[model samples]
Target: MTTRTPQELAVPVRGGDLAVTRWPGEGPAVIALHGITGNSLSFGAVAEQLGDIDLYAPDLRGRAHSAGLPAPYGIPAHVEDVLTVLDHLGLRQALLLGHSLGAFTTAVAAARHPDRFPRVVLVDGGLGFPIPGGADIDEVIESVIGPAMRRLRTTFPDADAYRALFREHPAFTAHWGPHIQAYVDRDLTGEPPEIRSSCVLDAIRADGAGPIGDPETLAAIHRPEVRGTMLWAERGVMNEPQGLYDEGRLAAGDLSPDRITTRRVDDTNHYTILFAKDATAAIAEAVRTELKEM
Candidate 1:
């Protein structure tokens, strides 16, 4: 692993251009995807630990620098952007790593273009949770990512105020530091005393109606040819006692254990599992170990 510095990039997408953070490395090429409402820096903590691979993380359309990207935002659109990014870089293949909503995107991309991604690493998301019978998918999407959606709609009086919003969040408060600070600052736009998240509410809402628990997501984790590791947090998004998935839930999910190996990251929540130092180190190790195994 080497220094993980942000090298900004802008690649054309459907509606407009998409911004990317290219962290150069001498080893393999890694295309990382951040969670919904999160910018590319979400992988800052973990990328810093892996000094060997070329890491490319994009601000998916409708978030951060890509927020201006137009309508028709959803998993399908995201998949197109990911492929476009690869083509723009002339990368025939690359290792895939995604967090939260990004994880879901990674899975589908890998499934659709296995030749482009031999394997992928999913952190805190990727698997589709079964929606209740007769439940409105829109409402369920709202419940799943409501806080992030709300924050996108919120207005902060100042940059400090914007940072305060995350400071109060249980996931980052305990692990706050420079990297987290960078991540927070990158998500803000507008002027001082009028700051707010860069994420677009419409884009997020459209993606919520995306392939959550859909056949695409399930195929990513259940296909016999699919291979990767799923790093789950012990705690939930709010840092609660239970997380999105547990041993029992995983066992009952009808996953292809032989294909996707699953493990729990102790004392971590959905956010920390990808950004916190220890958790990020674990993620770095997972990527490295798999590289060696492959």
Candidate 2:
């Protein structure tokens, strides 16, 4: 159970460099994608459990260290970025695992480039989210992301102050361990009184609004060529009872049973589904099983 340190590398893209964090291993490679406000380090816990599978997670353009990159930010742009990462690593194909917004990106990538990703795993996302009727995209983002959206506009006096804010979040208060701390710490940049999250608000807006709002992009999950599983969290953001994918929603039959399978991880929220020990173990086991089949 020793955790391996991730090696930070930069891959060239059309706009600029894409910052990647790699956990080296020997088995089939797995490319991970983080959430809207997340960075490559978001996969730290999952990587710790994946003993023999190589994992490459990138900070999508306009997030974390890749924040400097320009946009055309949306699902299509993110899909191309994933392709660039695969090409840069000389990988013909890899298992795709995406959490939250990353899940949306994963589905698009799998559909757009079936040869590049044979199997996909979505952690707490990828399924289309329900936007209440008459709500604008900004309202939807505000309601869904809540404090995270507010944090993007606020400047913390210091990194500790920023951590304090997240520490207060119901989702992280119990599961806030080393991995989560490291992920949050890496999210902050600049000096005191000016320190802010590395995620660019404009990029998040485009990414958050585009995939969830697009009918065609969300339909990618049902594509016959795209095979995948979705691991859902029982709790929603802030540890609320309403998760992103509720029982009713799952039973609603939006996803094709022939292409995608869904499973729920209990006692975890959206954020912890990929970071909590038991939850990460489940994700790791699912990943190992998928690789074995491949």
Candidate 3:
């Protein structure tokens, strides 16, 4: 893989500046969005594989460098921040690629604006999961996220300490590499003895309940103008047998085959899917193919 240096810039948002990372390329521009707890660097591995395309990733409010931004943080706030990025970059429209929570935000952005994004590629998210009625939001998040949510409450002494903690995660143990290490390193902030993930728990909780629970987001999946592909990891977040969207769940979702194409990526989980070489290659190819069709 070719090594590319990413340029970091701060774009003005409502309350503060939004940090963005741009991987320069000559091909058509692609805007990449990371998961709820993830920073812009979460797209680093995939961006490396997509050498022909210019990639822009932002640290959404309440995560990483953008953590200080005031909230009311949720899908709508993220959508507005994304539009600010698009305007800052002078892009009238760009191909959108979002992973996990980012995928939910992408769908909402496409539906609300319709003209800002020409194509959207949802990576391991976007389709609403089945949350039993009357289930507590906190419990739902705990069940779905498991250890990740627990880590948010703990503080690590340093980046190495944080990295060691993640190394123990089942989904990443086998595939742990420099890319994942760098991603984890960049996610940590604050001085030693107080260092922890930059993601704000409150913001995550709000975002979890907002887009995933919104009926309009599901309806956006069927919008004719909001066309894209949904990529599903065969494994779940913890490398479990069942993924976020299993075959049965996908078949029952509101997604129309004519609007969105769904494909399963083998041997990947929610977090590792974008980091895997084969999965990243497939994602990049899908973006290129969609851009051509447009």
Candidate 4:
């Protein structure tokens, strides 16, 4: 399949302009939301393989170019942003896909606004576990994503220096390429000798407490009006043997397979499931299959 350069645009919202990336395609429009710390380019590799639809992903507020956008930054804020994008584009309804925290965001959005985002494609993160009784939310979140939080605070001298840092990340060690490289580049901001991540510290903190197995999220998957497809990876962010949702966990979590469909992409970790060679191809094909039915 042939790939094309994506176009970037800024959609005005309440706090600031939301940065959006559009990958031209011939099929139905797809609106994708990235992970907590991820920007729109997180879907670049998937877009390369997916050529049948117009794919759009946003640099969610407090991330990448939208980093300048002010507070009110949680799942609700993100849901509002998603709706604004839909309204700005004049889309009554479209395919809604989300990865990582984005998966939860889409779930909440589908549950709250079924009229706008009825179709859902979830990647490796829609399921949320309840925090143990009396657990500290900040501590729990930090434990879950400590390294990323540290990376957000650390400063790099330049782009290559930052790249070297991520190159050492366990998740990308096996197969690092342009997709990973671009993801790294997009995360870096500020001038040389003092470059830092574009993701806002506060936003990450706020959203970390946002969604996970909440009532709204659960409703998104079980609701009759929403059609949901969940894709699971074989490994996790650290390329661990057990992924975020192993078979047992998935079976336990998904009580209603009738409303929500689940599938696995083998030889892929949570991060690679979106961009790695074979993984991306599988994702693209699954998307094509879904669009065909629609």
TM-score against truth, every candidate? 0.94, 0.96, 0.96, 0.95
Residue-wise lDDT of candidate 3 within 90-163, one digit each (tens)?
98989889998899889888888878887899999888865656777767887777688888899988778899
Ten contiguous residues with the weakest lDDT in model 2: 129-138
Q: Rank by lDDT, highest first.
A: 2, 3, 4, 1
State the local distance difference test value for candidate 3: 0.86
Runs in model 2 deviating more than 4 A are 130-134
TM-score between model 2 and native: 0.96
lDDT of 4 by residue, 43-81 (tens): 999998887689999999999989999998988899999
> lDDT score of model 1?
0.82
How much lDDT does each candidate structure score? 0.82, 0.87, 0.86, 0.84
Cα displacement (angstroms), candidate 4, residue 151, comes to: 0.6
Q: In candidate 4, which residue ranges exceed 4 Å CA deviation?
A: 212-214
Tens digits of per-residue lDDT for model 2, 1-294: 448889999999978899999999887899999998999999999998998789999999998899999978987888999999999999888999999989988988998888888889889988785465566776678788778989988998998899999889999999888898999988998899899998888898899885556876767777887787888999999899998887798877478777787889999999999888889998987787666645
Per-residue error for 4 in candidate 3, Å, reads 1.2
Q: Clashing residue pairs, candidate 2?
A: none
After superposition, the stretches of candidate 3 with alpha carbons farther than 4 Å from their true spots are none
Per lDDT, the best of the predicted structures is: 2
